[model samples]
Target: MKHTGFRIAVIGAGAIGQTFAESLLQGSIGEIAFMDLREKPDFLSDERYGRLTSIHELVAWRPNVVVECAGHNAVTTIVPSVLREGFDVVLSSVGALANPKIRTALCSSAVAGGSQLVPIAGAVGGIDALSAAARSGLTEVMYTGRKPPRAWSGTAAAQEVNLDTLTSQKVIFAGTAQEAALKYPANANVAAAIAIHGLGFEKTRVTLIADPAIRLNCHEIYAKSRSGELRVNMSNEPSPGNPRTSWLAALSLQQTVLNKVLGAQWAA
Candidate 1:
């Protein structure tokens, strides 16, 4: 199918959101617009794009697809409204879906509007395999996230371990995916993806670590199921503009946009 005149709106103008807007524009996907809460809008007068102040305006403008690169709060505040308008959405904040209320409302809105909610596979791989194994019944799923000690600053990890004085790796948190997402909202997307794809949030286990040795963020997944076993490990460089998010996440969002515009299938 030709996406000759497809119109897309992006939520947020932060590191991830701005990255998605520029990437989509460069790819010539369509007329790229943004919905944000900025006091002033960026890239609004480029002639190739536009911007809106609220979800109401975004819905009124009627975009073909909405790519949400904003944080979890956007998932609760903006995404449901978009889906309720019958527009498809690409959700980057997978961690937000761990909230039962938000997940239910988003899914219900999508169903009511006949839209699809596509989840981006950020900072990790092998999700296709893990999700497939789940079909046969997954026995267990574990996700471990490790990052530089400095990155854990301002998070609960700071209270558990001294971020500046930590010498070696320290296990900061260990629990279910739900708890991980709630406790570390900024660093929960990967764990949430593993849980949502391979198992429910309550059943999937999570471990978080603060390492003084590593600059790059790392994610590891282990899963066992009736069909087979799966293990995936990846180290991701942080986004230049946002240390809290992986650069790979922006790339994944780009791929999700391509999948929708090109009418191609994405395994994850």
Candidate 2:
């Protein structure tokens, strides 16, 4: 693919960010830049790529779209500001919006700048069907997230279940998507995405499990609506650079960016 003179700015130098950037570069899609506090990596040493230090610098670079791959804090603190600057933001940390205040801020900021805040369907599918079903009135939406014991480390799940010695699956949490996202921000972004597409956070049921037998991150969604009933199951490999993140999440972000640059309509 030839470079289209389109530019994309990514926020974060972490696993997902680097993966998405490398994919864009390999595809020869467009110019790319990184807005991160950390020093630039050697892979981005080419003159065409940029390492920016602040949102002001990002705005000056004039990227056509900004992708946020950073964690929840960045979504709350940085994404709204970027949107307020009239930049369409592709959000990977959808779990952050589980907080009503943060969600409201993002919405208001996007409206203020006449921009859109788009959330990628991370690590899972059937979002389009769910969204359509929602329009016809959804009665139930349930999400079950299962991952290896090691992947649940450092989160509240560690306190709920013994991740080290567990020989079988253990139910760590059962609650609404809002509570699940807030409690397990790093692991429950898919739950939040499903909630946003199928049902509101309060109505979406979420269950998180830590399994010793599964090496992959697994997601199961069951929804019922006036239109029909939907069920989806996905087992995704962990990102090589980060066990806590699904590799498919990075690819989803790259696809979202490509769709934006190519002016392709993406299913919500």
Candidate 3:
């Protein structure tokens, strides 16, 4: 398809959000704009870009796509409004999709407007293969996420166990992807993506860990289908600004924006 540069509005200025916006501008793909609750970040340095301020302002100057780099609250509030106005969206916060009613509403909005809301593969890989495996009737899929004990400091992990004393791997949380996403929203983006893609949320299993030994965030997935089995693992370096988010997550957002703007997309 021939391309007219897309008007992109990012919805957060945190590490992942800024990284995605910076990467997009660096590649010279689209006109970079941002929408956040906070003031314009000095990083982008473009007056045309800044905080969106309110939903009214966002609808007033509608962009082709709005990347919801913010959290689930943004998804529940801003994203629906944007979608209802016929704007497609790239949702980096996959955990928000765990709310079945919210997911249905968002899907309806996209369909009503003839647009799309896509989930980015944040930290994990093997999603394409895992999803393909699903079509063949997969049996088992599990996602284990591990981050440093200090990394889990602010989270409920501290309450579950003594994160400071953990010397080896410890599974602090075990449940369905839905529960995982709800309890570990900031940390379960990749796991939620894997669950939604492989088997519906209820069928996918999740394990959360606080590892004292590993400095970087880690993600691993194992799946067995009628076709066969696949195992994928990655130890991710956190985004410079947000230690909780994987660097690859921001890159995925930027790359998707590039495909939308420049019409150059990588094959899976």
Candidate 4:
């Protein structure tokens, strides 16, 4: 690596960003700049990093790598500029890539700057094999995401069923990845990631289930191609502080940063 202690910038000082900053410091990353709208948390006040409230300053910082813990709005507003400035970007909000226009623009920026825009697996896995299956000719890709009804309160699932008093499992949404991303923005990242990797967003099948019986967030990836078939199921605990984010999503950011700085091998 050209930079021994990689200089990095973290967007969104929320749960995921704070976790990544702590991991980067413990890892080989020399100095990290944490950016967010609010002050650093009581637990995260340290001297090895910088803090900022504006996403606009990222262009001037010119970090070696930028890890995005922020949501889709940050992806649309901040990521493109970072990519245009020839910096690598690791994104946790994979669902935002469902917007083909943003995907197109980001791809163009990465190509023009000769940088890479990497999407973290977040709460789901098997993207490495799914992408390979796509190249080998994919046949079927099934993505099933099951979260408690409370988790789906803000999504369309609430309107379809009584999330508060659901006696059994209920299907909130069943359609393509595009529809899932559009209807369920919170769960879109994982669903959209599967779609973009296996088949284009329009072709990837998605089923979102809200089950009252399950307390943990669960995700399943079933993919088949000419080469073979792969299935993996993951259950993640919700972030203690932020109920909306899964624990693994934050860990994905940490692991990705570790791999970049400490040369740790990470799954794609």
lDDT of each: 0.86, 0.90, 0.82, 0.80
Ranking by lDDT: 2, 1, 3, 4
Error of 3 at 133 (Å): 0.8
- Ten consecutive residues with minimal summed lDDT in candidate 1? 259-268
Which candidate number would show the highest lDDT if scored against the true structure? Answer: 2
Task: Name the runs in model 4 displaced over 4 angstroms.
Answer: 1-4, 37-48, 53-56, 263-268
Instruction: Looking at model 4, report the run of 10 residues with the lowest lDDT sum.
Output: 259-268
lDDT of 1: 0.86
Q: For candidate 2, write residues 1-268 as lDDT tens digits.
A: 6657788998988888888888888999878888877676765676767888998899899888999998999998899899999999999999998999999999999999999999999999999999999999999999999999999899998887778999889999999999999999999999999999978899999999898889899999999999889999999999988888799999999998888876732232
lDDT of 1 by residue, 49-126 (tens): 688888778888888789998789999988888888899999999999889999999999999989999989888999
What candidate 1 gets wrong by more than 4 Å, as runs, is 1-3, 41-48, 264-268
Provide TM-scores for the models.
0.92, 0.95, 0.91, 0.88
Q: Which stretches of candidate 2 lie over 4 Å from their true place?
A: 39-48, 264-268
Question: By the TM-score metric, which is better: model 2 or model 4?
Answer: 2
TM-score between candidate 1 and the true structure? 0.92
- The order of the candidates by TM-score, greatest first, is 2, 1, 3, 4
When 1 and 4 are scored with TM-score, the better candidate is 1
